[model samples]
Target: MSTNNIGPKRLVVGAHYGLKEWIIQRITAVVMVVFTIVLLVAYLISGGASYEAWAGLFSNQLMKLLTFLTFLSLFYHAWIGIRDIWMDYIKPVGIRLTLQTLTVLWLVACAAYAAEILWKV
Candidate 1:
């Protein structure tokens, strides 16, 4: 006969991406900050709010590549955050899947649009 009381046997589970996602999010944030600072410095030194000034800034090959990288980082950061929101609040599997699909489609479309704009400029 064994009599040891444990409160209803706890179960612990996880998808195991918590720390990885957290670290990636921080890295993405730093990338965005650096991009913003670069843009700000360019703007200040250029000393013009004209469309031509801005166009010249992004017309450089290095600037274009950096801008694309920033775009990618921003999209990935948003995806992780939004996915977390959907996972935490939405309980129904079908509804969650639908939201996730919509989010992915929207993000992809935005990426395509960004590509078009970046290349055009």
Candidate 2:
């Protein structure tokens, strides 16, 4: 086959991008671990078993900050994973571009919404 007609090598290129995704996944995983541990410890210390107690805890500034970070990291991690899947499986260039665009927009929207809610809290 002529080199000109050789379609982009799928799995090889996919793996190239996968390395970056792998790093992002690991970083996000670490963030999640720390966030989970801290959140659990905070909850345990608060002993806020009731709904109102939990609400109060969430209303606190520090807790709100932590919550925002937790959600943001989660959204980012999910976005990266889904994007990788799309890049690997979606072979059509136009469709892949559109999906990637939508993914980024969604992530930004989610992050903005989280920030707004956290700010209000």
Model 2 Cα lDDT, one tens digit per residue, 1-121: 5345355753344447468767877888888899789878877987867777677778888878877877887888998888878988999999999999999999999999989977775
**For model 1, how does the per-residue alpha-carbon lDDT over 33-84 read when each residue is reduced to its tens digit?**
9999999999999997899999989899899889988998899899999999
In model 2, where do residues sit more than 4 Å from their true spots?
A: 1-17
- Candidate 2: residue 65 lDDT (0-100): 83
Find the 10 residues in a row with the least total lDDT in model 2.
5-14
57, model 1: CA deviation in Å?
0.7
Pairs that collide, model 2: none
Top model number, lDDT:
1
